[model samples]
Target chain A: MQATLIYGAGDVRVENVPDPVLREPTDAIVRVLRACVCGSDLWPYKSRAATEEGERIGHEFLGVVEDAGSQVSGLRRGDVVVAPFVWSDNTCDFCREGLQTSCRHGGLWGANGVDGGQGEAVRVPQADGTLVKLPVEEDSELLPSLLTLSDVYPTGNHCAVTAGVGPGTTVTVIGDGAVGLMAVLSARRLGAERIILMGRHQGRTDLGRDFGATDVVAERGDEGVEHVRQLTGGDGTHAVLECVGTRQAIETAFAVARDGGTVSRVGAPQYDEVPMGFGEFFRNLTLTGGVAPARAYIEELLPAILDGTLEPGRVFDRTVSLEQVPDGYRAMNDRAALKVLIRP
Target chain B: MQATLIYGAGDVRVENVPDPVLREPTDAIVRVLRACVCGSDLWPYKSRAATEEGERIGHEFLGVVEDAGSQVSGLRRGDVVVAPFVWSDNTCDFCREGLQTSCRHGGLWGANGVDGGQGEAVRVPQADGTLVKLPVEEDSELLPSLLTLSDVYPTGNHCAVTAGVGPGTTVTVIGDGAVGLMAVLSARRLGAERIILMGRHQGRTDLGRDFGATDVVAERGDEGVEHVRQLTGGDGTHAVLECVGTRQAIETAFAVARDGGTVSRVGAPQYDEVPMGFGEFFRNLTLTGGVAPARAYIEELLPAILDGTLEPGRVFDRTVSLEQVPDGYRAMNDRAALKVLIRP
Candidate 1:
């Protein structure tokens, strides 16, 4: 089978790999139909030492269950399913609490000898807990949207939900990445009355406007914060969704947050020492949202996707075949594509 | 009138000052009935540069309305009241959102030209918003508890409330000062089933136990974190109330926080940066709570104090007259008193 691997900086490649086999009773074999590159994948693509053998990559996919272990229940062979970015035993205390990312028995994909989603097939451990059966056909038009249930859309919703974005609330989404645009859509779905999207890219911010952003600020640093505050009548937004993990992005998130509002950062933070000391403390702001528990939110969002009220798949501006994953990575990294879908 | 002043670090004194008078339509002159030394006060007492002319120093106090400005309503001269640590216009958006500490027109006591709570008389800005009328007498035995409603007790409640502490939740309170002990009580009131108080002081932890701390871990740093983990089946607690502002205290708070739990820091965090990057982000933990919006909680907590269901005032282990204001500061600074109540 063919899979994606990163040999070093800017070196994403498709290469032959062993077909997956069920290794545990809780495991199942998933032959991926559609997998996609995540913005987070760019972290390693931009830096990290060169490697001789490369490593497995990708953690978002929807697929057909090629095989199921004996202990797997509620799912079977040939059932189309979506797997969250991380594998978890849904019965663990953290999983039960809807914080599956912290599940004691769970682990990240493409790590510790686990199969990555950007491959022809994956051996999914804790299959019953990690995979959500999709009601759509493998080649359904809704495949793109359903694929996002694996990580992206849910992560956007997590940013809004954790920040308590709701009807009549004003929101500020920081970033113009696929996840940021998805957050704009999610906030609108959650009834945010106004959304201020801070981004420099004209194309991506245009997509953000289509998704629900009422205002767009193309500035950076202090200028962006000032623009957001100006658009919000000088009080800033009720919620700030930080989808960019850079220090400046986090700073802008807190800077443009209204007093008593929430700042939810769904992006994988790239820096340490957050500015949550005194200034933010006095404002009564709540800092939350991290590592979206996609498994827990997949069910809650499926109905909307099934009914066609949500079109998060619009985030995918480009699609590629398994052999062109390197091009996909470059396109995304070079800002030529919002997100690249991979048909394996 | 007489008032407490901080001429420099470790130099506190009581001296004659001009009598306070209403300065605005929203102001009122309060004859302080009781004022208490706060853990936050020690910050300025520890390192701030000396001044030739002393600055007013106290923020926690209950008083009688000596006079109300022409535009002030719902308050009259001689009305016994408790002023929140900060003055706020309750009608502001932030105040309406139950975050009065961030009220648009609010300002801290003893800052700028505002009269300090430790003074015999204080000109309270935004009188109607800052003063909560107390039913108890000036010299009532419940005065101690009623005074805590101004700051300490509500600060504790804010820690628990922001962390989402609730039935069956396990809580860890770092620090055993008056506020930490009050947090133990607050967690119990919020129905937390297990409360682990991390502190080394025998007397303070004893008070913490009395305030419903089910367990006490005297170890510091890593040992304390380990002890807390062992006590909670190696998963740590669901809520961590950080009542000490030092970096070490915050480190312990995060160390003993269970994945997906909340860390609420009510202390005046002395550091500029916080460890809220990748490590805490991956755990899906929520970091919240800052300066307490004490005014918003005073009404909610008063009934329990009035009905004898809560006794937060027990934290006041010593008392002093107006002339002994310097001694009060020294006593609290040296850990000779949990809290020092002042009578002028």
Candidate 2:
């Protein structure tokens, strides 16, 4: 089977790989239908995260169950499904608490000899627990939106929910990437009264406006906070969604949040430490957010996608075949595309 | 008039000072009846937080209204009252949101020319908004407990409340100092099912038990987390109260919390930065806390203190006169007493 692999920094290729087979009583072999390059993938693409020989890439996918192990329940062969970026035995106490990312028996894709999502087929452990079954056909027009349920959309929702972005809340989203745009959509869905999108690119900010951002601030750092505060009548927004994990992004989130407000971040943290003392401590702000529990939120967000009420798939501005996965990475890294969808 | 002053690190003295008088239309002259040394005060006492010429110290006090400015309402001369550690004009939006510590017109005690609470008389800015009047007599036996409402007790309650400690939740409190012990009491008051107090001192842990600690973990860091996990059936506690502002205390608080749990800290943050990446981000944990809005909680906690239902003042194991106030600081610094009460 053809699969995406990264040999080293900036080196992505599609090559033949061994086919997947069910290895556990609760496992299922899933034939990939769609996969995508993620903002996080760029981290490894530009660092030493990739190997000299080769390493399976990607952790987001929508697929069809090709085969199922005996212990798998409520799911069978040929069924369409979405697997969260990480696989977990949903019955664990942590998973039961809606924190599948911290599940005791869970592991990340492409790590510890596990199968990566950007492949022709992959063996999914705890099949019934990790995969959310979709009633729609495998090739439905809603595939892109449903694919988002595997990662980005749920991550954006996590940011909004953690920031307490609800009715009448004034929100500031600190990124113009696909996840940040999705956060605008999620905040709108959650009934936020005002949404501010902060980004440097005019194209992405335009898309953000179409996705429900009432205002856009193209400034960075102190100037960005000033713009947000100016738009908010001198008091900053009530909630801030930090979709960019850089130190400046985090600082902007904190600065633009009103006293007693919250800053929820879902960006993969890039810095080791964040200052929480001095003025930050006395403002009564709440810092809440981490990795999104996509498995926990997918079921809740599925109906919106199926009913056509949400069009998160618009985030995918470009598409590629399995052999062109490298081009997808370059397109996103060079800002030529927001997100790239790959057909297997 | 007399007041406590700190000229330098390890230097505390009781000396004659000018009497306080109403300075603003919204101010009031408060005759302080009781004042106490706080854990946060130790920070300046041990470091260079004090000025060489001497600065007024102490921010916890219960007092009687000695005089009121023309605009002061709802408070009359001779009325007994408790002033929050920080003074604020309650009409601001931040105060209306129950975050008086962040009120637009608020300022910390001993800062920006504001009179500190340790003096014989304090000129309280925003008097009508910052002081909570009491129905009890000026010399009531409840003075000690009522004084706690000025700071530590409310600060502890803030920690418990921010951590979401409530019915059926298991809580772990780091630090056995006055604030930490008060957190145990606060958790119990909030109906926490089990309270674990972490400290190495037998004397403090014993008081912690008396304050409703169901378990005591004498270990620190990784071992402390292990003890808490073992007690919670290897799942960790539902909430953590970080009453010590050290990196180790913050780390332990995060380490012992179950997935989706909260860590609320009220201790003055001693470190500039905290690591929130790596494993911490994926745990789905919420870190929420800062300086306590003591004024916001004073009204709610006053009844309990007045009725003897809450004896937070028991933390003050030693008492001293204005002339012996220096000894109070020495006793607390040397760990000879948990807290020190001073009468002027």
Candidate 3:
């Protein structure tokens, strides 16, 4: 089977790899139907994150189960499924408490301890807890939304909810990436009265608008915050969803949120010493964000995707063969595509 | 009238000052019956926070209404009252949402726009909103606890709730000042099963235990966190209330709280950065704290104090005349008194 591997900075390759086989009683072997490049992938690709010489790359996927170990009870062969980026034992105390990403024995896929989903076939650990079986037998058209549910959609949802975005909330979504676009949709679905998408691209910004962004701010930094504040009656947005992990994005989110509002950062923060000041404390702001516990959101989000209430998968602007995975990364990195999906 | 003023760092004097009078339609003059030196007062006295020469200080008090503006309803002249250190209009959306400290028109007593309570008579703005009336006309016996209700007690309660402290929670309280001691009591009142109070002084630590601190870690910095972890089955505490606003205190709170636990800081941070790592994200820890909106907790806390369910004001050790307030600040700053009460 073919899989993507990172050998060093800017070094990505699709090479032949052994077919996945179940090693644990709870493992399930899945033949991926669809997978896509993630913003997080840019961390190692851009050399912002430490990396080994060779590391397996992707984590988001929608696939069909080819085999399941004897202990797997909730899923079986031929089952179409969406696997959250992080695998967890759903029965753990933390998982039951809606913090599946912090499950006692949970592990992140695609980085050490688990196999990457960019491969033709992957082994999923804790299958019963990690995999969400599709209610219908088969629907090829649902792959895009399903793929999004694997990571981005749930991540966006987490950002919105953590920021307390709800009816009558004026939301500001920083970062016009696929996740940020999805956050626009999530915030809208959660009933935000206004959704502001911050971005620089016309194509992606348009898609974000279609997904539910009510406005767009093309500026960056202080100017961007001022733009949002102006849009929100000079009081700043009621909730800010920070999808970009950079310090600048976090600062923008903090600056644009209302005095007592919350800044939910779904962006994987890489910078230390997030610049915050007296203004933040004096106004009482809450900064909550981390890896989205996608598994916790699947149950609610899946129905919406199936019912056509959400169209997050539309973020995929280009599709490529498994052999052309490297090209997809270049196109996304070069700002030519929002998301590039690969069919293995 | 007499008031304590900060002539400069480490220099405080009690001197005769002009008597306070209602200055606005919403203002009320109160004759302080019981006022106390706060942990935050030591900040300026110890030169941690620079003070302007001859600036009036202190904000916690239980007093009798000397006079009321015509617009001040619900409170009458000669009524016994506990004034929240923060003066809010009670009409702002933030105030209505129970975050009165962040009220749109609210101001902190003794800071910037507000007058100080460490005087014979203090003028309270937004009187109807800032003052809570005692059910009985004469309740001098409840003065100590009522005085605490103005700041420390409610502030401690805020820490407990913000940290999500509840039944079966293992809590750690940093700092053994009046507020920290009250936080220990508040944690017990909130049903935290285990509480570790980090303090070195035997007197303060002993008082902390009496106030329901199950364990006392007489260590500082990393050692304090390690001791708390050791006391909590090596997983750190379920919640941490940081009542000391310093880099070390904030870091200690962060280090002591367990994965998925919350660290609530009510120490009025002067200038510091809360250092964080990826571990905070992966472990699902939450950090939330700010100036405690004592007004928000007054209604709930007042009943508790009135019913004898809590006695946070037991922290006060020495009583002095308004003229001896300089000594009160000195004693508390030097750790000679847990709390010092002043009568005007």
Candidate 4:
């Protein structure tokens, strides 16, 4: 089977890999239909040290169940499904609490011998618990939107939900990436009265407007905060979605939130520490959000995509064949594409 | 008039000071009847550099309205009242949202030329908004408990409320100081099913039990976390009240909380930064809390004190006359008393 692998910095390749097989009583073998390069992948692609051997890559995908073990319930072969970014035994207390990312028996894809999602086929553990069955037919045009349910869309929703973005809330989304755009959509869906997108790229900001951003701030740092405050009548927004992991992005999120507002961040934090004293402590602000529990949100978001009410798939502005996965990464890294979808 | 002043580390004195007078159309002068040394005051008391001049001290007090400015309404001379730790106009957007501590025109006691609460009389800005009228008589025995409404009691309530501690939830409070003990009391008042107090002092833990702690973990750091996990059937508590603002206290709050739980901290943070990457970001945990909006909570809690349903003032284990305020500080600093009440 052909799978995507990263040898080191600037080295992504599609190479032959061993085929997946059912390894546990609750396991299912899934044949990959679609996968994509993520913003986080660029972190390693840009700086990971070179090694002679390549490592399996990718953590988001939708596929068809090719085989299912006896213990797997409510899931069977040939069923279209979406795998959350992390696999969890959903029966754990944490999973029951809708925190599958912190499930006691869960593990990330491409780690500890698990097959990466960007592969021809992969073995999924806790099949019934980790995979959400989709009603859509194979090759449905809704695949891209459904695929987003595996990670980014749910992540954006997590940001909005944690920040308490709801009816009449004025929000500031601090990124122009796919997740940030999705947050605008999620916040609007949650009935936010106004949304300000903070991004410099005209193309992405244009898409942000289409996604429900009522205003845009192209400035950075203090200027960006001032711009958001200006857009919010000098009081700053009631909620801020931090989708960029950089220190500046997080700081901007904090600065642009009103005194009693919240800043929910789903970004993979780049800095090791964040100051929570003095200014932050005195503001009565809430700091929430972490890795999104995609499994918990998939069920809630699937219907919107199936009913054509949401078109998150538009984020996948470019598509590539499995063999061109390297080019997909290069394109996204170079800002030539917003997001790249890979059909296996 | 007389006031408590801090000249330097270990140097507290009762000194003559100018009498407070109404300074603004909205101001009022309150003759303080009771004031107490706070846990946070120890931060400077233990290390402040020596200076020839002294600074006014204390922030928790309740008293009789001595005078009112022309514009002051709803408050009359001789009316008993309690001032929140911070004064706000109440009409500001933040105050309207029940975040009076962040009011646009609010100011903290003992800051920005404001008279400290531990004085014979305090000139309270925004008097009509910052002072909550109490029906109790000036000489009523409820004065001590009512005094707590000025700070510690409301601060504890803030911790419980922010952490979402309520019916059937299990909570862990880190610290055994007056505020932490008050948190245990507040958690019980809010109907928490179980409360755990983490502290090394058996004396404080005993008070914690009386205040409503169901369990006490004397261990520190990792052992303390393990102890809490063991008590909660290895799942950890649903809410954590961090009443000590140290790196270890914050870390323990995170470590002992269940996945998707909340850590609400009211302790003035002594550390500048907290690590929020890797472990923190992967868990769906929430960190919320700040300076308690005592004014926002005073009304709701006042009835309980008046009706004898609460006795938070039991935390004031020692009492001193106004001239002995320096001894009051010394007793608390030396751990000879949990807290000291000063009768001015």
Candidate 5:
């Protein structure tokens, strides 16, 4: 089998790896059909130090089950399914509360000796709890959208939902990445009346507009804040869906959030400290959103995607085979592609 | 008229001042019957540099309407009322959303030239919006509790309520001051199944127990984290009501907050930065709460106080005349008084 590995900064490779086997009573071996590079993966790609061997990378995938341990229930060989970014025992208290990302018995892909999603095969633990069966065919055009259920789409939904976006909500989405565009779509789906998409890239912002952004501001920092404020009648929006985790992004989110508004950060935070001082505090704002519990949302968001009401797959501008995984990483890092899809 | 003024660190004085007059069409003059020194007051009390003229102090009080401006409505002379720490036009969007602290036209007492609550008379801006008429007598025995409706009690309720306290919820209160004790009481009133109060003072802890703290942990920092962990089956509580503004308090709040739990902070944050790094983000925690919109909660919480179903005023452990306010500040700052009541 072939898999993606990170050797060092900007170093990505596809190499032969041993086939995955069920290691736990609840584990299952999955032959991945679809996977993609995540915005978070860029962090390690930019700063990870060199290593002699390599580290498994990628956390989003859709695949067909090849084998399942004896204890695995409700799934069998050839079952098409989507694996959430994190594996969780859905029966845990946190999982039951719809926060599978915080499940006590949960673990992430590509770490702790687990298989990375950007590979030919993955060893999925807690199979019954972590994988959601897809109703689509193996080669259905819907596969791309269904694959998004594995991470990206759910993450975007998490940002809007956590920020309390709903009917008549006015929202500002910072970032023109795939996740940010998906958030624009999610916010609109959740009935946001107005959305301001912040990004300097015309191409990506144009796609964001197609995803339901009513306004686009090609500004950064203070200028971006002013543009959002102007778009929102000088009061700012009711919620800010922050898809960029840098300090400047967070600052802009806080700055453009209306008094009593919420700022939900889905971007993996790059900084350690948050500026939630007396000013933000006095305004009575709420700070929420974290690692999206994709597993919990797959069931709720599936109907729309299956019915052709949502087309989140539009985020993928380029596609590559397992062998070209390294090229996909480079294209994404160079900002030449919004998101790259990988077929293993 | 006489009012409390802070001339410098550890320097409080009762001095003659011009009588308050209605300055706005919506303004009303309130003759304060009861006022209290708050924990926040002690902050400036300890560090405020000496000034020749002195600054107005105090923000909690219950009073009788002395006079009303020509355009003021729904309030008449002699109507007993409680003034929230901040004055707000209840009709503002933020106020309508139950976050009156962020009301567009709101202003804090003792700032922006508004009369302080510790004064013999207060010229309340936005009278109808800032003062909630009390059904009790001018000198009712429940005056202490009724007075609390102005700030302390509503603030505690804001902490618990913002943390989503409800039937069978588990909660941790990270302070034992009047507000923290009130939080314990508010959590109980909201039907929390269990409440853990962190405080070292025996007297205050005992009062907290009476206020509904099922368990008390006196330890701070690492030991405190372990103590709370042991209390909640090593998972911490569902919600943490942060009533102390110090860094240690915020850290403890996050440390003891269960994964997917909420930490609502009502304390006026003394620091500028919040430590919400990857660890907390991955836990899917929600950080909320701010300076309480007490006016919005007054009507909802007033009934309990009036019916003897709740007694938050027991937090007031000492009583002093207007002239002894300086002593009251010292006693509270010295840890000799849990809270002080002032009669002008």
Candidate 6:
């Protein structure tokens, strides 16, 4: 089977790899139907997240179960499913609390020895918990929507829900990437009356508007916060979605939220020290949101996707064959594509 | 009138200062019946906070309403009241949301020309919001409790309540000052099953034990977290109360909370940065509480105090006249007192 691997920074390649087999009683082997590149993938591709000789890449996908281990319940051969990026037992205290991303018995998918989805086939551990069975069979048309259920859309939902974005809320979305765009949709679905999307590119901003952003602020730094505040009657937005993992984005989200509002940071922060000031503490602002447990949101969002009530897959600006994932990475890294779906 | 002024680090004196008079339509002049030195006061006394020459100190007090401005309503002369350290209109959006400390029309006491309660006669702005009427007249027996209502006790209550401490929750309390001891009581009042008090001295620990601390961990840093975890089935406490402002205290609080648990930090974080690691973020821990809106909790706890159901005032280990405030600051600064009450 063919899979994608990153030899080093900016060196993504598709090469032959072993077909996945169930190694544990809780595992299920899936024949990949569709997978996609995530914004987070750019981190390892751009940063020095040291890649060994040949490491499996990708964390988002929809697939058809080819085999199931003895202990795997609720999943079987020929079942179509949406796999959460992180695998959890779903019975741990953290998972039961809807914080499966922090599950004591769970770990990140595709990292370590666990196989990832950007391949021809993969073995999913804790199959009963990791796989959300699709009501419909694997079809070409529903691939994009099913693929999104793996990460971006659910992540966006987590950002909106965790930030307490609701009816009449004026939200400021920092970052115009796929997740940020999805957050706009999520906030809209959650009934945010006004959303200001902060981004510089025209294409992404237009998509943001389509996704329910009422306005766009193209500036950066203090100017961006001022723009958001001006649009929010100088009091700033009721909720802020900090989707970009950077000091500037976090600070901008903090500055653009009104006193007592929340900053939901879904971005995977890397730096040792966040540059947020203690002024946020005195202002009674709440900070939360990290590592979205996509599985927690899949059941709730499945109906909307199946019935055409939500079109989150509209974020896929480009699509390619699994062999061309390297090209997809370059296109996305260069801002040529919002999201790239790969057909296996 | 006499006021306590800090001329520099370790230099405090009780001297003659200008008598406070109502300066605004919403102001009220209070003849302070009781005031107290706070743990935060020792920050500047210990040369931790930036200080200027001859600045009046203290922000907590109970007093008799000596005079009221034209617009002051619901309050009359001779009425005994406990004033929240944060003066808010109590009608703004933030206030309505129970974050009066960040009220749009609110201002903090004891900073930049704001006359504080360390003086015999102190002027309180936004009197309608800051002053909580005491059912009883100003009596010596109620002095300690009423004085605590202004800051520490209510702050601790806010921390415990905000952290969702309840019958099954295991609460770990950081800091053993007046507020920390008060938090031990607050957690007990909220029905926390296990109250782990982390502190040093025998005096404060004994008080903590009396206040319902089920266990005491005298160690600091990682060892303290290990101690708490060991007591909590090796998963850390379900709730943590951080009442000390330093970075170390905040870090300890974070380290001692279980995954999916909350850390309610009423501590006035003075440091520029709180170093959080990947472990903290991935654990799904929630952090709430800061510059506690004591006004929000005062009404709920006031009756308990007046009826003698809650004895948070037991935290006051010493009392002195307003003229001896210098000695009070010195005693608290030298750790000779768990808390010091000043009678004006």
Top model by lDDT, which number?
Answer: 5
Query: TM per model?
Result: 0.98, 0.97, 0.95, 0.97, 0.99, 0.96
In candidate 1, which residue ranges exceed 4 Å CA deviation? Answer: none
Interface RMSD of the candidates, in order:
0.9, 1.2, 2.1, 1.1, 0.8, 2.0
Per-residue alpha-carbon lDDT of candidate 4 for residues A86-164, written as tens digits (9 for 90 to 100): 9999998888989999888999998788888888888998898999999988879999999999898999999999999
Select the stronger candidate by TM-score from 1 and 3. Answer: 1
Q: At residue A205, give the lDDT of candidate 6.
A: 88
Per-residue lDDT tens digits for candidate 6, residues A133-172, read 9988777587798789999999999999988898999899
- lDDT, each prediction: 0.91, 0.90, 0.84, 0.91, 0.92, 0.86
Better of 4 and 6 by TM-score: 4
Worst 10 residues of 6 chain B by lDDT: B273-282
A1-344, model 2: which lDDT tens digit per residue? 99988888899889999999878889999999999999999888888555677888899998999999999987988999999999999998778988899898998998788888888988898898999999889779999999999999999999999999999999999999999999999999999999999998898899899889999999998898888999999889899999999988898898999888899999988887776775777887788899999999988898888989889999999999999899999999899999999898
> Order of candidates by TM-score, top first?
5, 1, 4, 2, 6, 3
Please identify model 6 stretches exceeding 4 Å from their true place.
A48-52, B48-53
Candidate 5 lDDT tens digits, A75-134: 999999999999999998889989998888989898989988999999999999999998
B1-344: candidate 2 lDDT, tens digit per residue: 89988888899888888888777899999998999899888888899555667888889988899899999988999999998898999998888988998888988888778877787988999998999988889778999998889889999999999888889999999999999999999999999999999999899999999999999999998888998999998878889999999988888888898877888889888888777774677777788888999989887887888778888888989998888988888889999989999888
What ranges in model 3 sit over 4 Å off? A48-53, A137-139, B48-53, B111-114, B137-139
lDDT of 5 by residue, B277-326 (tens): 88888888888999998998999999988999889999999999999999
Our model 6 lands, by Cα RMSD against the true structure, at 2.1
The candidate with the higher TM-score, 3 or 5, is 5
Candidate that scores best on DockQ: 5
Clashing pairs in 6: none
lDDT of 2: 0.90
